[model samples]
Target: MGVIVDEQVLTCSIPPARFFKAFFVDSNNLFPKILPTVFKSIEYTEGNGGPGSIKLLSFQEGSGADVMKHRIEEMDEANLVYKFKIIEGPKMGVLDFESVSSVNKVEGAADGGCILKSVVTYNTKGDNQNAIQETIKKAKEGFVGFFQATVGHLQSNPDAYN
Candidate 1:
């Protein structure tokens, strides 16, 4: 019915502390500031963004990802990583699938900027093989844009994000 998808070494370059904010921003004031349209708003219906929290993220336009609701299945601030399972919005059905967005590395460069490698894996529900494939491809492009935009954002406001 479904299949698991994986992406390895998906890389991007961003200013130092940019990726840190991705994982550290307060759920209430994070996405809108860093990634506006990509993350329109987040409502923490349950806990306060820690593990086991529930959130609804509204995406603007049709930026490939659209929008969805997710539950924080796992989180590690120290390691700067988190895993959340998609609970609603575009999965295919009720409890259709899940995803993991993990930051493999957040390191600084001697010259400037940071190299960020992230792995985003997905598993689709039964009989949704085609959708799973499409989703994986979109994830790749989205990551590239995300990296470039993040870097541009920091570079534009130097003092704010660097």
Candidate 2:
């Protein structure tokens, strides 16, 4: 299997703690509400909400994916770090990936805002470098779009996640 790693950083005006809380901690609840066009719902299938837990995420029609299963690897609230692995999804099948995992860290920036750093690792089935790169690029763009939408929601609501 071929292993591919990618990193992305996004900066926003929200504080690290609050951003982490909204984006990572309460994402299951907030995402479906805020981005209904993309997410249908996120429900825990096993093990509560901590490490080893499985979450079944259902997406809306035309979103390019129907459902995805994610296993929580780690969630460090105090440190503002989260990690998860995609165990099942149509996107994985289409991309020919054996496994996909991501680690996200939120840190306070000097400007009183926050920076989100994400590292994604993809285990592929064959030696299709171009296909893998394209998949990774699209995934990163989706992540950024989601982050921007969540940030906009939080910025406008102010008291929503607080």
Candidate 3:
């Protein structure tokens, strides 16, 4: 199998605590409500939400319309870190990957904002590493756009979640 990895660090004006609360804690409800154009819903199918739990994210029609299944590998609330593996989804088809793992870490900034570091690794099925990497590059653009949209939503309606 082949492997492809991507990493990114994003600086945002939202505090780490609030960011995690809105994105990870309340995301199941807030994501769909806030970004209806991108996501349809996010729900747990196996466990309540801790490690080993499985969650399915259903995207909006034409926004892939894919149900991505993810298994939580680790959750460190104190440090604000989350790790998960994507077990199934349309993304697998496009990249021809056996699995995909994502690790996200949020660090509090002195200015009440935060820096988010994200690492995504793709395990491919064959030798089409170039093609897979290209696809992943394109997907990352959309993913970043979605993140920006979420941040905008939170900033504009701060009390909506608080």
In terms of lDDT, the best-performing candidate is 2
Better of 1 and 3 by lDDT: 3
Clash pairs for candidate 1: 1-126, 1-127, 2-126
**Local distance difference test values of all predictions, in order:** 0.61, 0.90, 0.82
Instruction: For each of the candidates, give the backbone clash count.
Output: 3, 0, 0
Across residues 59-104, which tens digit of lDDT does each residue of candidate 1 receive?
8787645767777766665555556666677653554464443334
TM-score between candidate 1 and the true structure: 0.69
Relative to the unseen true structure, what is the C-alpha lDDT of residue 81 in candidate 3, on a scale of 0 to 100?
91
Residue pairs with backbone atoms closer than 3 Å in model 3 (clashes): none
1-162 in candidate 3: lDDT tens per residue?
Answer: 877788988878888877876777667887888788878899999998899999999998887547889899988878889899988887476557888999999998888898889999988887776777776887788767767876898799787555
* Residue 160 lDDT, candidate 3, scale 0-100: 57
Give candidate 2 regions above 4 Å deviation: 93-95
**Model 2: per-residue Cα lDDT over 90-158, one tens digit each:** 747655799999999999999989999999999898778887787788789889988998899989988
Pairs in steric clash, model 2 = none
Residue 26 accuracy (lDDT) in model 1 = 52
Better of 2 and 3 by lDDT: 2
State TM-scores per candidate: 0.69, 0.94, 0.89
